[model samples]
Target: MINLAARDILHGWGKFLFTGIGLGLLIGTTLTMAGVFRGMVDDAQVLIDNSGADLWVVQQGTLGPYAEPSSIRDDVWRGIAGLPGVAETGNAAYLTIQMAHAGRESRVMIVGMDVDRPGRPGAPGYLTAGRPILHGHYEAIADERTGLQLGERVRLRRHEYTVVGLTRRMVSSSGDPMIFVSLKDAQEIQFLKDNDALVNERARTAANPAFNRPGVPGLLEAAQASSGQSRNVNAVLVRLEPGANPDAVAGEIQRWKRLTAYTREQMEDILVAKLIATSAKQIGMFLIILAVVTAAIIAFIIYTMTMAKLREIAVLKLIGAQNRTIAMMILQQALSLGLLGFLVGRASAGLWGPAFPKYVLLLPGDAIGGFMVVMVISALASVVAIRAALAIDPAEAIGG
Candidate 1:
């Protein structure tokens, strides 16, 4: 017996090929969605890796920077540095804002670091181009995604910043490009109030009899001066001494300083499990919907193909073809379509992955799993077509 499925496919290759391409495009979109979720998880991991800190210290009773608002005095790091098992500590502030560069605005995560020294907890591990911040103020190192070039000027509130260095892959957990600036600048930008708010606050303070008390020399002036400066930071990043236990160091800080300390593992859990939990759920729902739609499409295509071959199937039955032969032919055709579509989908995903704004990490394991799912869906979808083919009566071929 001739191989009927191959002959049928070759005879109607034009329409079959077009249908396969359309299905492949849908599969490609599904694969890309999976990559997007993987990319989000990877971005969180990268943010953790690049911080180069073993512990994070934040305001007491708070989840810390990414999960919620956390504010502690910048000077807390000084006390933390002297704690046992602590080798080095840095005051870091994190705030996300839309920044303008060369007429385009992009969202960026501003990181305040102690550029005064190398190998500090929050400093970028390395620079791809130019040099790290050399000035005590008004200089920055930006992630390349910000479209900033060395010496380019970027404005933050009333001050202007010059991009001094560019770093690669230093992004926030949400994939926002990071701009690393001096601790002072970040404090001023994030903590300081605007001029209008400041004037009102000063006026309010002066009117209060508490700060403007009679016989209290210089009381009003001191109160006004303190309100103008920013002394708070989002968190303190800590690097432990070699062989130092992270939990032990964290415990020491929590015990004496009355602040919250998180080990690297704890912070990672907050970022991936809590901070992005909603986003992960939304992506997972999309994956399920896409999978169901793909199965439906395969069933429709295979059933339609079987219906169109009813006359030929009747002729085969009249010539003594077994039911098993007919069912296998349909199953083979369905699997062939699935294989063709998967190869196209994989190629399409690879081609368009980099063009996405956020990272798109296509892991090999996901592809393998997807292929297995596709084959299973194909086999299941062929059942409908096989049932229709097996029901055709041989007498239909010899009807009057």
Candidate 2:
């Protein structure tokens, strides 16, 4: 028997090929949506991994610093460091803000770590360029995504910092690039008030009779000076000893220290499951809508093609073509169009993935699943055209 599907497609190859390309662009957008979701997940995972902490110790009754605003006294790490199975503890302060650099503003997460002591939990895992922050006050190590080069100065609140080092893939759960500064600077930036506010605070403290009683001049000065500094940190990053159980250590910190401690796994759950849950749902809804639209387009295109060839279909019916054979031919054409679209979409996604501002991770598993979904949609969409072709009268060929 002659291949009816191939013959029909060859006869109108221009329309078929262009229609496939148009459908392919839509498929590419769908793939890109999936990639955006995947990138968010990867960004969250990278944040957890790059922290290099076995446990995160934050204020009691709160999630970690990334998910919530957690403030604990900087000295809390000293107590946590002495706990059993605690090899080392580092105080960390986190603040997300818009940072200005070289005539542009970028959203960045400023991390304050003990840069004086290398290999601390909160420090950048590695630097791709220059050197780490050695100075306590103004030196910074920034993720390359922030577009900061070596010796470039960026202001954070009250002080300017020189970008001494650059790192890769160091971002917050929200995909904001990270800038590492000294613990003291981070504390001041996150907790301290501006100069005018500081003056007003000092006057307010001085006006209070509690500190300004007769013959208590020194006492009032002490109160004013202490109120001007910030000794608070967002969280304490803890590294456990070899073979230490993270859960046990976290429990001890929660019980004795009266603070919230999260093990690595639990923290991952908070960041991935809780932090990005809404975004994931939005992406899922988009995928469903795109699938429906794709199915609709396939059905419309195939139905129109079938209608345009009613005379040919009638001729085939008059020439002893089985209904099963006619149905198979339509199905084949739908599948072929879908196959072409999928190939073009996959290639387009790869070519344009990096052009996106945020990360777009196109996984092979997603691609495979997408291919299967497209084929199924194509098969289902052919039903409308198949029914129309089958309902035609064979006598229409002779009359027309």
Candidate 3:
């Protein structure tokens, strides 16, 4: 009537507990890997949702600002604005640039938006502090992750702007903080050149026979002026009327405007499936390898633990203990070990997730899935130890 499993575990508590801890750490890494993948997908979805745009109009035959380099004339929005089912359209320019703040430079996605309309497409979904960009000149808004406070001036390219507002969770697809500036300033920073380069370019153009022809009175001057200006934006964000079909509006723009247009769903596919697919696969492979390693360690530990109790197992078999009872003892012990490991892993992942630079969204469902997987693997691993224990001859107990 003795509880053989409990007695054995208690007798070697050190080995059992330490072995469980080692396995638990591996399980924790596996869980964290899955969480990292989920976080990336969630961040991509949030980016699309916060844009408040049903359709994204980009350059012809190319992905938008998130996936590739897309350049559309700044005035392209006017054409899409006049389309059917379009409730409103906003001109948005996105350029990734390094800006200096507090004597350190951090990579940021500079978003150019219209300050006149506070609730337009491409504006921050919500603010944590200060106000939205109310002026179009030298004021700026930044994500809280950038560590920039209100009234602080940051230098970008050739101009300096003061941070007048702060928002939360506003990040680029790469997890870089987003800094918002006026369309004019962003354009300048996007295509600005040094004074020396500008003067040299002017001299080169004026020396051209075609531009300096006598019949063309203002040809050289006009060419130089045009070359120094940037009149293009990355993409246009469009918000359709309520219940308007985004697919139809996108089709219309692609056909008439000869440009590529993507609905929210399409853009999400590009970001999640195309942009981050390889990284996701890499994480998945790591999870698989970790699971294998965890299972191997558990099997070896359990087999070794069971082997140490050979005398007890032999005596139990000789004293009328059924084979099922011995097998169940091993199975129960394996499952218990798995449960302990899972708890440790879940707690560890939660503790370290926030400290990660990128967003680490650990969902409850994923944690539950991880627990199930560990238990199954542990059960499979116990098979080897169970078989080995069951093979021990009952006669061994009597030293025969």
Off by over 4 Å in 3: 100-105
TM-score of model number 2: 0.95
In the range 91-162, model 3's lDDT, one tens digit per residue, is 888988887777777888899987778788988888888888878788899998888998888888888889
Give candidate 3's whole-model lDDT.
0.88
lDDT of 1: 0.91
Q: Mark the 10 consecutive residues where model 1 has the least summed lDDT.
A: 98-107
- As for TM-score, the candidate ahead, 2 or 3, is 2
Question: For residues 1-400, could you state the per-residue lDDT of candidate 2 as single tens digits?
Answer: 8888899999999999999999998999999999999999999999989999999999999996989889899899989999999998888999999988778888999999997689989999999999978778899999999999988888988898888999999998888899999999988888788889988998999899999999766999999889888788989999999999999999999999999999988998999899999999999999999999999999999999999989999999999999999999999999999998999899898889888877899999999999999999999999999999999999999994
Q: Per-residue lDDT tens digits of candidate 1, residues 351-370?
A: 99889988999999999999
The reply for model 2, stretches above 4 Å from the true place, is none
Best by lDDT: 2
Task: In angstroms, give how far residue 74 of model 1 lies from its true place.
Answer: 0.9
Model 3 pairs in collision: none
**Which ranking of candidates, highest lDDT first?**
2, 1, 3
CA RMSD per model (angstroms): 1.5, 1.6, 1.8
Rank candidates by TM-score, best first.
1, 2, 3
